[model samples]
Structures are given as C-alpha cells and as structure tokens.
Target: MSSPIALHTIQYNTQDIDNDTLILLYKNLLKPRLIEEKMLVLLRQGKISKWFSGIGQEAISVGVTMAMNMDEYILPMHRNLGVFTTREIPLSRLFAQWQGKASGFTKGRDRSFHFGTQEFKIIGMISHLGPQLGVADGIALASNLKNKNQVTAVFSGEGGTSEGDFHEALNVASVWQLPVLFCIENNGYGLSTPTNEQYRCEHIADKGIGYGMESHIIDGNNILEVFTRVTAIADSMRQSPRPILLEFKTFRMRGHEEASGTKYIPQELMDTWASKDPVINFQTFLKDQGVLNESLEIAIKEDIISEINTHLKIAFDEDDIVPDKTNELNDVYKSFEYQEIEKKPETNQLRLIDAISDGLKQSMERHHDLVIMGQDIAEYGGAFKITEGFVKQFGKERVRNTPICESAIVEVAMGLSIAGMKSVVEMQFADFVSSGFNPIVNYLAKSHYRWGQQADVVIRMPCGAGVGAGPFHSQTNEAWFTKTPGLKVVYPAFPYDAKGLLATAINDPNPVLFFEHKGLYRSIRQEVPIDYYTLPFGKASVLRKGDDVTIISYGAAVHWALETLDNNLDIQADVIDLRTLQPLDTETIYTSVKKTGRAIILQEDSLFGGIGSDISALIMEHCFEYLDAPVKRVASLETPIPFLKQLEEQYLPKNTFESELKSLLEY
Candidate 1:
C-alpha cells in the first residue's frame, strides 16, 4: 500500500470558541457514535434490519455540517448519520425511521439512512452511490439561477470517485460554475477493495484539478481543521458560486455494515487506526485545553444517554407502518381533475418540430422555473434544430447546453425537479438514453413510490426509425420506460398531439418520458392551436372510427396504421392513437376493440418484448370475449436498424402493419 498523505498541522485557540460551543460540538460528534452503537445493539436483537456505521468518520460530517448555514442543503449518503444529527433531525424521528415506525421520514417504506426530509433540505442518497453527486450539481444550479446564495454540500466515499457520475458532475459544475461542495469521505476501503486497487492517485482530491476547480485535502479526523476550512469555503462559495472538491482522509473503523466481519482488515492496521480515533483524540485535546473537565464530560455523557433513552422509548412505542394492499396505489402519481379545453379557432399549420419548439416556449413563458437542458440546445438549438432560438428567447440561464453526459443530464434533472423546478431534458438521440437508464429507472421512476417525493421531470427523447438515420441515431426505446412504474410515457404522432402532450408533461407533477419521432419532425404538419392548451393523459384519440377491425398504435406508427386503413377503404378499421402509454387509455382501447371484434396492434419497436405485446395482453385480458379473432401485433424486425435504405425500410413496422392489416381484414 502507498504511504499515507502527509497531514498539515492545524492550530486553533480554544479560547476563540466559548466552552459551551466546544462542548456542544463534542456532543454533536458523540450523538451519532452513540446512536450507531445502539443501532448495532438493535441489529443484534432484531430491532433494526441493518446498520452502516460512521463510528470513526463522525468528525468529518459534524465538522462540515457545523460550518454550513442551516438554510443550505446537504445531500448525505448512508454512512453520514452525523450529518443527520448535526442538522438537528430529532433523535426520536431518527430512531423511528430505523425502527420502521409510522412517524418516520418514509413512513416505514425505507429504513436506516435511506430517508431524507425536503423540509430539512436534505436529499437522501439512493442505492447507487455516484448519481447523488449529479443531483447536488442540479441543486446548486437551481440555487444559482434563483439567486438563493446557498451552497449544496454532497457526500460520497472514496470508492464513488471512480464512478462515471463523479466525473460528469464535477465537469458540469466546473463548466457552469455551480455552487456545490463535493465532499469525499476517503474511508481507505470500499467494502473490501483497497484504495490502491480503486485508483492510482495518492489523493482523491487530485481528480478535481483536472476538472479545473479548487481541490482541498484535509485531515478528516480533526474537527477543528474540517470546520475551519469548510466554513471559509462555504462563505466564499455563496458569492463566487464555484464548485470545490474536498477530500476527507478518514477511516471506516468498522465493517461495511454491522453483519459484515472485519476479518479482511489486518490487525496491525486496525490497531494503528484505533490510536488515531477522532472521538478519543478530540476528548483528549479538550481536556488538555482545559475546556472539558472530568465532571463536565460525565454530565454530557449522562445527558446524551438520557436523550437517547427518551427517543428510543417513543420510537419503540410507535406502530409499524408497513404498506398494505389498500394504500399500495397511493401517491404513485399526483391526482388531478382533468378538464378539457375547447380548441381555438385561430390555428397555425406547424410541423412536429415547430410544435414541440412552440410548446416548450409557451411552457417556459408560463412557468419561470421551467428549464430546458440538453446537448447543443442553447445557441445551436439542437442536433435537429428543434430548440433553435430558445436561448435568445428564454436567455442562457433557462436554456442550458449541457456537457455530453447523458446520465448526468437525467440525474441533474431529477435534482432540479426535487428542488421545486420543472426540468425538461432532451436526449439528443433515443439510443443515447441507455447511458442514463439507471437514474431514469432507479432514481427518477422509483423516487415517488419510495419516498412520497415527486420527480417532476420531462425527458424528451427523439425516437423511431425513418429517413435512414441508422442504428445509433434511430431507435424506438419507449418499451424500456413504459415498463417502469411511476413514469408517464407520451408518444405523439401529429403536431396537435405533440404540442398538447408536451405542454401537459411540463405541468404534470410526475416524471414523464416524451418520445418524439425524428421521422415525423418535419414530415408531419397539421393545424395546431396557436395559444397554450394541454391534452389529458391516458385519453386515447380515435383518429378514424370503423367497425370491421380496431388498430391501436402510437408515435410514428399511428400514421402508418391510419394510411393502411385509408388505402384499404373496404377494411374500415377503427384507429386508436395511444398518446400516453403508461396511464394507458384502456377505456378507449376496450371501447374500440369491443366495437370492432378484430384487433391489430402496431409499434416501431422490435417484435419481441415490444409495447405492442403489452397492448395485445391488455386486449386479451379485458377485450378477449369481444374479439372475433386473435389479436395480431405488427412490429419492426427484432434487430438493430441498418444504415442501408432497403434494410432500414424493412426494419420498421410501416410495411409490416400494412401487410398485417390485409391479413387481419381477411380473417
């Protein structure tokens, strides 16, 4: 193993801070340590499920938290219980959360450091370690835009620095000059992987230099050193608004969790670190400085013991708040009464691209907190020139051109949405959304169901295959998001639906994946309303009504289904456009299928595991007896779209839908 970095000696005058303040600081450090020790006891007794102890790393959290103002936000990870204590989270509530009580932060949905209170400006960390860093960037960005003069402090372990999100977050923060303090708790070991195996750098702070930002390496065990430096940085950041990377060189002192054994750690190293324990060393320093006497130390200990016992009793008495079948569907999506707005007389003939642009403009004009962020979206408009002139109209602050980090884009949007801003993120191509899949699935989609939190983000994906855009450029990946719960999937074919649906997505209080067909951006034009209006989600529009067969489709495929029906006038198929896929307009679908016994489902995605399969299943379940024949599905070939014109033509479902319709009519 490499030799440890040399620690710079920091001197402090004990008299500078009053004895009461010093005693309270020591108590803050003691709170989490005692609580965690008790948590270990509970773990052994089956009172709590797990414990991620921050026993040795108390000084880092308490010190930094003390340095920041109470109004500022702190995004904490699982190991940072000291932060929760320092932030004045009630011990009873903390214990209640650990005990899975009804009065806890997540109402017993999550336990043990997996909960956060927006009221306290604390964003709880998800299972994925690195994405929260990007979220912190978004929080800081929002503060900057709103001129809040607040600095968001986000915590991570030395292991998280190796993740791609760390790089993406720091780069974006550096480029945008966001006010974020990136805190890395260098605990020497990530589970069992040692620092030497994790990265070659002697100090994790060195990575910050490459991002063109300030970097600091501090002795995390020293409370005075951490507080003194963090206070200075936090105060300066409010005015200058720049990100700082601070590495806290510390040790875990325990296993990754209470159940994990420490046999992997060498005995010699454990003994060496035990001597440098922050709590013991700080106590010794206080005694030497004549700050804490034996009598006072005993009194403080008794007081903390009494407080813990009181909270423990209350938490233990609380009822277990487990989810039941009755409340299972509660808070999945925000409930709103839908009111239909009549179409206006004055309408403009717009292409799909222009309608999307206009809808974004109208939404931004209505809500000042709405922000548009994507690659090349600000001045250059976008790759397809959809957001052209947005920067000029909305200004650069609202129209942001982000770095080429798709995961960060989505995660940051989640952060912004959590911070009470509506973020509309554009994936330059639908294929690139794979890079951001984790946040979309794990963080954004599950956030509401997990914590009663709303991720009001609109992720605009330019999707589908046409005009020979090839494999990388043209991909209909809507099936992936449609399958995920807590997400509203919107795929509009015409200009009117695109504008109306996009507007609704912006105003909706949940995460929405708005898929726009690149093939129809300029090819499809219709007379859309000039003024602002929103179409209700989960309401399918019947484009053409007929009695022979019912055809269901969305996005670019809807046009092909309609064209096929128009070409074969004798077929007389009822065409239904499912604009929103998640809160599927099953009422309209069932009604149409009930009317026309024969059904056909069409999609631009592949045949297997496509959204059409879900629709087919839905029809089979509800409209099975009504159907005269088996539900037929027409979808693209199960292969990557090729670049050649003929292959690309063969890859889409347009031809397949036409052929399938002919066979369905004959049946």
Candidate 2:
C-alpha cells in the first residue's frame, strides 16, 4: 500500500494565526466549492450559460489571498473564485455577473469571471491566459517606481506557462526584481491536455530557476500549508522586492466547463483525486485539532448555504440589463469638450521624426507619470532614432529599454495604465507587431468595453513600405487595428500632424496605435509648433480643394495623392488627409464627395481587406447618391514586400495613384 499523504500541521502560537482564523480560511475554501457546485446546478438549469469549476483547487487561491494585504493587487484567472470570495466580493454580484444581469460588475457587458473592481485592486482575467502575467509585471514595476511596497499576485495554469507571455513576463520581473508572485496552479490538466504532454519537467516551478527567480512547490490540497508558505513569501517580496514563482500541485475535479464533458477523464484518476479534496481535507484537519466540531461544521454550512441562497434570490430578482444601443459608440474613444490650445506660427523646420521626438519630450516634461518603453529605446534611442535623446533627458527609469518581448511591452503598458501611470510602447517594426497581437487586440482594445478599465497606452508602430526595408521591417498593417472596436488608429503625414496627433494620443484616456511612416520621417520636413497642442481625432485636413474628384488617403499615401493632383492639374481632385483611420472622419469624406461628385481611396496596405475597402464601403453607403462615377481604390499588390528596391517600389501604390485618379476624373 502507498504511504498516506503527509499533512502540514500548523502551530497555533508560532504562526501568529489563531484557530478561529484557520477555521475561517477553511470556510473560505469550502464556500467556493459549494458555490461552484451551485453554479454547475445553475448551468444545468440554463440560469448560467457556462461554468468553470475550481472545485479541487480552491486552497491555492484562498491561501494566496489570505496571505496578501488588502491593498495588494491580484490578477486572477477564471478559476480563481476563492480570490474573489476572500476579497469580499458580494455573492450577489457574482451571481448577477454569471447571469448577465444589470447589477453585475460589468453591467452585463461580459459574462463569467470577466469583471473587476478597481476599488478592490483586482484586475479581472481575459480569455487569453498568459497576457495577464505581463500586466502583473508592469504593475509591480510601477509600484516599485512610485516607492509603493505593494506586491502583485498573478495566477495562471500549467498550460499557460507554455505561452510566450509567460516567459516574457517572468524574464522582465526577474531582471527588474519587481514585487510579483506568480502562482501557477498545476491542476494536472489544461482543459484536456495532460501535464506529461504539456511539459517534460518534473515540476513547473523548475522553469523559474532558469529566469533567475526562486521557485517552490507546495501541497496545494493543504490550505494551512498554502497560507503559511505564501505569507512568508509575500512578506519577503514586500521587503526585498523580487518575483517568486509558486507551483501548487493540485487537480481539477470538473471538466473545463459544464459543456465540456468529463468522459475523457479516467474514473480511477478521478477517484484518486476525490480522496484528496482540499475542502474536506481542511475540514478534517480542523476537526482533529478541536477547532471545528460536528455542530459548528453543520452551523457553518447552514450559514453559507443560507447566505448564497439569499444572494441568488436577490440576483435573480434584479431586472435584466438592456444594453443601450444609442451608447454603442461611447467609450470607443475618449470624449471630452474641445478646447483648442492656441498655437503660434513656427519658424524652425524639423523632420517628422524630430517633431515626434520633441512632442514626446514636451509631454514627458508635463506629465511626470509618462513612461517610454521599447527595445533599445533608452541608450540606443530606437531603431529609427526617434527616441534618440530620451534616455539622456528623461533618465533610464522613465525611458526604459525592454527585452525583445513585444507582447510584454504592450502588456506592461496596460498594467502601468491601470496603476495610474501613462506609458508609450514602441514596436521595432510594424511586422513585429504580429508577435504581440493578443495583448493589443484581445486585452488592451477590449479592456474598457469589457470591464470599464482604461488601458491608456500609445503603441508607436513604424510602418509603410519605403527605404527598401523589405517585408519584415516595412509594411503598413494599420487595418488590423482599425478593425478592432476599442482601438484608435492614427497615421500622420506631415510634421505638424505627427507632433500634434502624437500629443493627442498620449493624452487620450484610451489606447491608440500611432503609425509613423518611416518613408516620410525624414523626407517630410515642416515648421511644426514649438509648444504643446493636441489636434482632435476623427477630423480630416483638406490639403487641397477641387470640384473634379475627392482623393482620400492618410500617412505617406496622402503625399502621393497630392503629387498626383499637382502633376495632373486638370484632374482637380480634393485631397483630404484622414489623420485618424478609426473613428474615421466620415462627415468630412461625405462632404467632400458631395462637392466633387467622385471619390478615390488610396492606401499603402494590400488591397485585400485593406482600409480602402472600408472607406469604399462607407462612401458607397453614405455618398452613393452624390457620386458621378464609381469610387476607385488604389492600393499595394497582395504580396509580401520584396527585398529588391525596384520590386519594392513597384509593390507600393504611389505610381498607380496618378493613373487611377486620372481614370476616375475622366469617367
């Protein structure tokens, strides 16, 4: 026969926690298990659409929550109900959230563990598992910079450790010695993949050693053991401020969700884990220590059941939330009354890159919380040298040099934003953004709509095909972000627009993807304003007025459109520069199209699913009746930009813009 599992006994006096407190911890563990059971029941009754049961792993979350101070932040996963319960989240709110009711934290916008309370210092988890780890690292970084001794606890699964974000976040935290505790609940399986298939290491904590961080494994079934160990770790982290990865060896008794059947799990394995249930084990340990008797256990159970029942009744009685269709566009971008700052005529001409750098310097001087982060942004200035003198002026603390981790750059910005700091992230190249797409599209863009949280980050993307940078370094990928609801896309052509739009993006309360055209960075020079000023988003600049046709473009293509019109004076096209792609200037486009009675949309991105298609559809819907001819769309070919300079120029739509515009004018 196998030896029985060893129990970690707690000494009443030495641990500084009384028997009553231990019992309460046990209660915290049991309450979530009972609530999960109720959620499964509700799932069957169709009251809840889905359920993720943390049935066997409640001890880990509760222990970690009990160990940390109330002010410490926690980035929890979907299975972390114990963390919510220990933080005193009302049972009614949890039910309301699961039921998608108006009283829930998200006001029925999101369902199931996708809500957070800023007051409680908990950031809710998104569907993506790994990105939150990076967010935690950023929070820890901000806390350390602000001289706040707050430890951030982030939870993840063994499966999530395989993600790139897991590595990036740990690497950053280790290098910076940030105050973060990465709690990995090793629950034997990730949805359906077994641990043996996921990784070869004997313990998940072993990975932390490679990152130069201390790692430990704990008996996840023992609540007292978890609390005792985590309390010490939390205290040490607050003092010295280093990350520690804790791997809790536990099991998940239920399937990934109610809809996901448990037939894949073996009966023998289920029986083995059932014998080691955390809640039952904790109750037994308390009963053996004379802290919990049969009558007290019965009374505690009754009180919990009664409280849950009362909350459920209240939640069910609440009115169903009806989404306001009129406010669908609200919160997509920051809305504020427009008060234009006075601008003086400039005498000194600067390149677009210099203008942007100057704007960043001015913004950083004005806002103490502004931070700049990217690869080689500190000492080397950046790949484009746009941040050349930033480190010397702002110091390394404010202008940080990040590892080659793109996702973490955005994730850290999101974290800093949440912690009341503004951050600007730089993607080395537009193509490299594919590596960090999840944080931008899934988390940063949807944070406000899902949880009413502000991810006030500005990601600078150096885009457009020019200088023979080839496919990897040169590509205009703004359409990908423009399609996302919560993101604002800005592409400025002139130095004046570049400086002003960048300032506006930095000040906006929402996330912005500012695409800087590398081709125009040095080629375009203009006398930009010396002082701080912000141009409004969703406003277009009419570069030239004409009665023949309306030419709509942004970034480098706007210049191409202007040149085409200048060369063909008879074409007489109205060139409108769309400074912002998302929250597009539809009114301006419509007004110009109505006057010209013709339209031409030009872009540097590929034709397939490009921004031109969206613009064409918009004009067709709003200005179809005003058109004298079919709208024309001129864009790059649908292929990766070639390394050869001649082929690269051919891949761009600049040369084609003149011919397309002339054809539209003739028609």
Q: What does the lDDT read for residue 238 in candidate 2? A: 87
lDDT of 1 by residue, 1-667 (tens): 1122233233444537777778888999888877777777888999888888888898899998998888888999888998998998888998888777877887777777776688777888888888899999888889988999999999999999999999999999999999999999999899988899999988999998899999999888888778878988999998789999999988888999877868899999886677667777777778778888989888987888889899999999887676686565766666656656656789999999999999999999999999989999988999999889888888999999999999998888988987889999999998999999999998888778767778989999998888788889999999898888889899998999999988889888799999999989999899999999989999899988789999898988888887876787788878899998988989999998899998999888998998889889989999889988899998889899998999998788787677778787777
Please state every model's RMSD to the true fold in angstroms. Answer: 3.1, 2.6
TM-score, one value per model: 0.97, 0.96
Which residue pairs collide in model 2, if any?
A: none
User: Given candidate 1, what's the lDDT at residue 429?
Assistant: 95
Candidate 2 lDDT, tens digit per residue, 222-317?
Answer: 787899999999999888999999999988888888678678899999878877878776676777778889899889889999999999999999
Q: Which portions of model 2 show Cα errors greater than 4 Å?
A: 1-16, 334-339
> What TM-score does candidate 1 reach?
0.97
The local distance difference test score of each candidate is 0.87, 0.88
